[model samples]
Target: MALEKFMKIKETLLGVDIGYDSVKIVALRKGNGFHQLRSSNIIAIPPKSLQQKSADLDKIAEAINTARKTARPRISEKLAVSGLPESKVFTKIIQVPQMTDEELKTAVPNEAARHIPLSLDEIYLDWQKLGENSKNSFDVLVVAAPKFLVENYLVLFKKVNLELIAIETKGIAASRSIIKKGEENTIIILDIGAEATGISIFDLGSIKFSYTIPHGGNTLTKSIAAALKMTNEEAEKLK
Candidate 1:
């Protein structure tokens, strides 16, 4: 029955985060009833290839394929979770009356409609119930991303032959790595990427607020290039 039990066990999950200038992949396995990291890899993208409306899809797919091969020994045919770029997603924490999940299910959409600027049909929505407050109200985290943007990511994963199980916002995924279960103290997690910076506040292991700024490492590089009268490439190398 040992072999049977092993066969019944579920496959582990691979987490993927694709940034403007790099792609990161991580695999986790269950050990002693807790999740432990198995392997991780990061692949860099070519310069000037991730511009808006002009991203090099083929290059990204190849990088993902390479990352998969790099971690082949630790990852099998497991499902993967990916995160959309923080610049493209919207996240907010809102208050609602404490109620059952069934009631929240019906109430969330209406509440989201007020917060999200786009039409509901244009975006994919997801939410999580945080906890009850002093007033016996619930704090819910809402996430919305354009449907077309999500579909493009799905297409990219399909091209690489990767099975994507879920897509989350970058801030949420980063919070998972920085916060521990049942942690009481509040803290801020900052992710400075090549093209954007994402800031998130975690309280009691749940994200209470998140914000994304367009300025990042690239901006600093450009400033250095201007100050020294050097090309971007030279400034980047100096940085």
Candidate 2:
């Protein structure tokens, strides 16, 4: 998702992260120089509730509402920002010939089709010009997500009475939170979640590359359970 100018200065913002295992909500008050945490809450989802062909949207909506109320934010307008999981997005860094902004707009979609497996009509495409990579070429970060996936999120948030102002990839959010400004060295970030792991490489404060692996905590728990001859619950607790 691209950034939107929906928030005002010093307004309280809600961060909603819906994952495979749980729904998490964080409220933050924006200050002059920093953000203050107001409240945070997490509620677990029923197992396999989100794995079905047709997910239990009512159940998921209930969890989101419960988590939001439990956090107790002072948001009267219910404005929020959500993140798309890395596993559900396609991102790549590509080099393009130096061109003006008007020309780059036409070039990015053509380049996106070459890199992304899906047709251009099926996905929402966004790109940013990183900088000049060479005398004749420049680096462009291309991000794409399926249209249906985004529409589903919009509907889900509507069910919870929240207006999703902006949506971003989790990898970008993690890098912004964890990386220091003006960092000179390259670093890799590993975000391990219940069902997936996000691997992001950052160089000089920008994300250079990112990837997602299907196996995560759940996979580890299963492996541990098999190796130790314990129940999955026991393995989870031990882990």
lDDT (Cα, tens digit) per residue for candidate 2, span 87-199: 88898999999999999999999988988989999899988899989999999999999887777788788888888888888999878778888999998999898889999
* Candidate 1 error regions (>4 Å): 1-12, 27-40, 44-59, 70-78, 134-136
Q: Which digits, one per residue and each the tens of the lDDT, describe model 1 over residues 57-104?
A: 788889888887887564555567788887778898888888889999
- Could you tell me which 10 consecutive residues in candidate 1 have the lowest summed lDDT? 1-10
| Number of the predicted model whose lDDT against the real structure is largest | 2
Clashing pairs in 1: none
Candidate 1 TM-score, C-alpha based: 0.81
Lowest lDDT block of 10, candidate 2:
1-10
Best model number under TM-score: 2
